[model samples]
Each structure stands twice: as C-alpha cells, then as structure tokens.
Target: MDKAGSEKSIIALEGWLQTPAGVYMRAWEQSCLDNLTADIFGYNAVQIGMPEIDALAASRMPYKLLADRKPRAAREQQRAVNLTLDYTELPFASQSIDLVVLPHVLEFSTDPHQVLREVERVLIPEGQVIICGFNPASLWGARHVLRRVGGTSFLPRTEELISMPRMKDWLKLLNMGATQSRFGCYAPACRTEKWLHRYAFMDNAGSRWWPYLGGVYVVQAIKRVKGMRLIGPAWSRKTAAAPSAVPATNKRREQQDG
Candidate 1:
C-alpha cells in the first residue's frame, strides 16, 4: 500500500487496540512480552512499530529505543529515542543490536520478508528477536472473515494475518532459529464487554486442547551465523603465533646446516 494508505490502516488498527476485544488481546501480549524480555540481556535493544505498546517495558537493557514510521510529540518530548524511519531501511549498522521486538509489524507491512531481512541484518549473531502477530487459523480469524462477508468491517483495512508455519518458514529463510512460541487470547470475538468476559473460559480450555488456535501468538527466534569460529583475544593469538613460527624457522635453518 501507499504511505498515506498504510498510515490510515495503522491508525485504525491502533484505535481498535483500545476497544474491549482489542484490550483483551493487548493484555495477553503485554504479559507475554514482559516474561519474554525480562531475562534478555543486551547492550542495545530496539522495538519496531506499535509505539503504543511499549514492548520493552520489562527489559533491563540500558539502551532501549523505539523505531517507527512517524515520530510523535510525546515521545520526542520525553527523549525516548524514537527514530522515524521505514522498517525496511533501518539506520543502525549490521550486527549491532542485541535484541529486536517486532509487535504486529510483519503482517501489516507491504513486504514482510523485507522487514524481517532488515531485522536479521541489524541483529548480532545469536541475538534474540521477538515477533507478535495475529494468528490466521483461529476463531478470531473466522470472525474477521464472517464480518467481511456480512459487509461489516471490524478489523483494520487490509489486515493480512500470517499463520505460524508460514512465519517459521520466513524466519528460516533469514537464518533465524525459532526457539519458542506462545499462543493466547483464545476468546472469541464479541462486540459487548459482557460477552467477551463470558468467553474467558475459552482461554484455559483452548490452551489445554487447541493451543495453536489462539487468536494471537508470540515467537522468539535467535540469529544464527554459519561458518563462524570462536577465537581467543588478539594478544593471545599473537603470543601463540610467535613461538610456533620461531620453532619452524630454527628447524629449517638446522636442516639446511646439516
């Protein structure tokens, strides 16, 4: 989609995120992110998109920043290091960031693969990346389809939800190893708060039986670098090199004399 169109869609989704059902999804996502990031240690961590969620609130990293397509006045005033840049073209150097959190960014992008490629580029070897997205093969997804068929629009325009297997394939293409994943918010879509609360039982039941069919999912992956070798410090390498070279040189000289 075009820039203006994408912005409008994002705004609509953000608004929905404040509604009763959306609020329910946000709470589960927050709890998942909090637990996932708490133990993640890093020098530089970044959260891409979804500025309203504060995805890194539980992280203990000293440097945490948010990157989004647009800058907000409140974040600017707070000096929160919110960079206004496209997800496909991050300004950071390769292998610099230790952790990256992408909250509902992939499915919304025009090119989700490009977004993930950029994510892999900025992450250090073995760095962690957390991605949260709406699951397409679920009751919530069914609701989205039914609403569309009934000529009622409840979700964001052009909402392209991705399935778990497809997401795993994308991560694999980027040389990222999928470490863990979680699914939650099993309740069905309900317009009224009362009905939404009533369906809370689905959360426990679905988790025990149909866990993969949750409305939303969180995935954690680690960047993997091939053909990498572990080496000692420069000083140690130089020190060890000198003795080996000296012995070889002396042996060659002695053979020549003989």
Candidate 2:
C-alpha cells in the first residue's frame, strides 16, 4: 500500500477500534502493554504506530518518541509525534534506539518485512521490540475469515492477517529472538458490549486452556548480535618466570647459607 492507502487503512482500523469489540480488544492490549513496558529500562524508546494507545505510556525511558507515516495524526492520541517517517525507512541512526513498539502495524503495512527490517536496523544490540497483532487461529480470526467472504468484514479489509508463527519467522530472520509472548481476548466475537462482558470469564479459561488461540498476541523480542571473542591482544601479557628446582643436597646447602 502507498502512504495514502496505508493512512486510510489505519483510519478504518481506528474507527473499528471504537466499536464494542474493538474497545474490549484495546483494553486487553493496553493492559498487556502497560505490564510489559513498565519494567523495560532504557534511555530511548519509540512507538512506531497506533498512537491511539500510547504504547510506551508505561515506559520510563528518558527519551520517548512517537513516529507515524501520517502527519501529526491529530495528536488525537494525546501524544505528539517527534518523527514522521515511513516504517520502511526510519530516520534514526542504526542501532540507536533502545526500544521500539509496533501495535498492529505489520498487518497494516505495505511491506511488513521491510518495516521489521527498519525496526531491527534502528535497534541497538539487545534492544527490545514489542509487537501487537491479530492471530489467525482464534475465534475473532475465524469471524474475520467468515466476514471476508461477504462484502462487509469485521476487521479492516486492508489487513493481511498474519499468524503468530509467521511473525516469529519474520523476527527470527531479522536476528531478533522472541523473549516473551502473550495472548489474550479469548471471548467469542461479539459486536455488542453486553455480550462481550457476558463472555469475560472465558478470558481466564482461555489463558490456561488455549493460550495460543487468543484473538490477539503480543511478542517481545530482543535483537541478538553475536560478539566476536578476541583470542589474543597485540601486546602480550607479562608472565613471571619460576625458579628451577634443585636436588635435595643443594636445597639443604641453600637453607644453611640462608
């Protein structure tokens, strides 16, 4: 998708996020982000998209930046944008950012692989990235698949729904290791708030019984870069020489002289 097309997709997704099901999904996503980001200690952090939820709100990073392809995005997300750039090409220097948050950006991006590559490029070694997205293996996903057949779809039609396994593969290809993964929003797809609240108990059960089946998943990954081991230094380390051992008779004579 082009810039304008991507922006329109985001707008549609945002609109859907206001619905009852979307509200529930957002609450779950927000709670998960808060818990996950609260303890991530770092100097710099950036939330690439989904300014709607303030992905880094719980982060204590001194330098926090909100980036999006769109201009300003109305600051409606309550957070101001520090950088407006394409996900495929981040303005920051390579390995400069400590943390990058992507809230449902991959499924919406034109080239999710390039977006992830950019994220990996900007992340320092051992830097972390948090991703939020839909799972194609859940009830919500099934509903989307069913709706896709008809003219009306539950989620944004522009989305190219990706499974968690596919995402893991993408991150792995970028040399980013998954450190933590979570799934939530187990309730059946319900358009009304009342029905959604009715099935809230399934959240706990789903967590224990069918974790990977959750509608949404969050993956926390760290950029893994292997360091080369220096075998020897240019200047050799000094070594102390040991005195040679003498025969028993010579040892006695030396003791007497002492």
Candidate that would win on lDDT: 2
Error of 2 at 146 (Å): 1.6
Could you tell me the lDDT of residue 225 within candidate 1? 99
Candidate maximizing TM-score: 1
lDDT of 1: 0.86
What lDDT does each candidate get? 0.86, 0.87
TM-score of structure candidate 2: 0.86
* Residue lDDT tens for model 1, 65-155: 9888877666431334368889889899999999999988886788789999999999999999999988888887777677767756655
Model 2 RMSD, rounded to 1 decimal: 4.7
Q: Report how far residue 42 has shifted in candidate 2, in Å.
A: 1.7
